[model samples]
Target: MGRWDPDARGRLERAALELFAEQGFADTTVPQITERAGLTTRTFFRYFADKREVLFSGEEELRERFIEIIRTAPADLTPVQLIRHGLEAAAETIFQPLLEYLRTWRAIVGSDGALRERALRKQELTIEAVLTVLRERGTDEPAAEMIAKLSNLVLQTAVGRWVAQPVAERPLVAFVEEVFEQLRSTVAGEPVHR
Candidate 1:
């Protein structure tokens, strides 16, 4: 079978989630994932470069998906608004199915020291993705990077709440917009321009 089979990848993902929740990311090994997936080591290597990657391959897809999506966003959408759409698109593409894994994934990384460091590295790559998209749109490099990073923070916060919140009435994109408004109010009330 090819390395990129969605079913195979899903199996690996499920296996990794189980293992991570049980033993934590640091203790989880590729062989463990392969064994749990009932696949050979060769298969695991085919789908992911390493064990840590099972947690993160979605971020790579998120980068590509967000760039393609934000490019076509309506011109009248404010930058944050456009980014909210991009985040929601990426989330729907990547997260809705993985909600089952979210708790396990968080448990593995939540309090572990090494997993936290690795998660930060993954976040840096995500930020770079945002900057790349902003630059490609011909936004001033600094300002684009600034706005992209801000949007990233907004998305991060929004997603954290959306996933954790018991409230089911609002969509994630709507929550992102709500947080942005909250941030705007905070900014507008600041004592002085920094």
Candidate 2:
């Protein structure tokens, strides 16, 4: 590869995901990923701290996006509305375009215990960030905490359904909206529909 390869990070990520799927995450190495990507080991390290980082490289950015959504939301919106707005935005901007990649990534992460633990920790940190931002925006602590946790559940459920569908005809935002409706119905003591 040249010194200035285009999309080196993307190439590295695709290569790593392919390797992880074929050989298992534990058996894949930096050299193998670099080799598959036609990149140097130095290039791999420049993009990711380790193989695990490949799957989680966008976590901090995602968390920041959520915080920004909460911080800039209109004051009149309820906590649940704020979470729904943020999740829908995320689905449209982040998850929708990466549907196929995420399908593979989720499978690889689900197969490994360590990766699942790391994913949970990252999720907790994201929820904490959302809670802090909500409180800073004048929401009470209890409501902010509940909203933050509920946001995580909503996002996870939406992504799970979006990825698991046999035909992804609807966008991920649709799934987010569906989940929020289900949440609202359940809280209202109405029959929750699939």
Q: Pick the TM-score winner.
A: 2
Report residue 96 deviation for candidate 2 (angstroms).
1.2
lDDT of 2 by residue, 1-194 (tens): 76798799999999999999998999999999999999899988888899999999987987787678778888888888888888888888777888998889899999999999999999999889988898888999889999999999999999999999988898999999999988888899996456
* Per-residue lDDT of model 1, residues 93-149, tens digit only: 665555545646766777678777887787778778778877777667877777777
> How many clashing residue pairs appear in each of the predictions shown?
0, 0
Error of 2 at 152 (Å): 0.6
TM-score of each: 0.80, 0.92
Model 1: weakest 10-residue lDDT segment is 94-103
Model 2's TM-score against the true structure: 0.92
**Residue pairs clashing, model 1:** none
Error of 2 at 134 (Å): 0.4
Q: Say which candidate scores most in lDDT.
A: 2
List lDDT for all candidates, in order: 0.73, 0.89
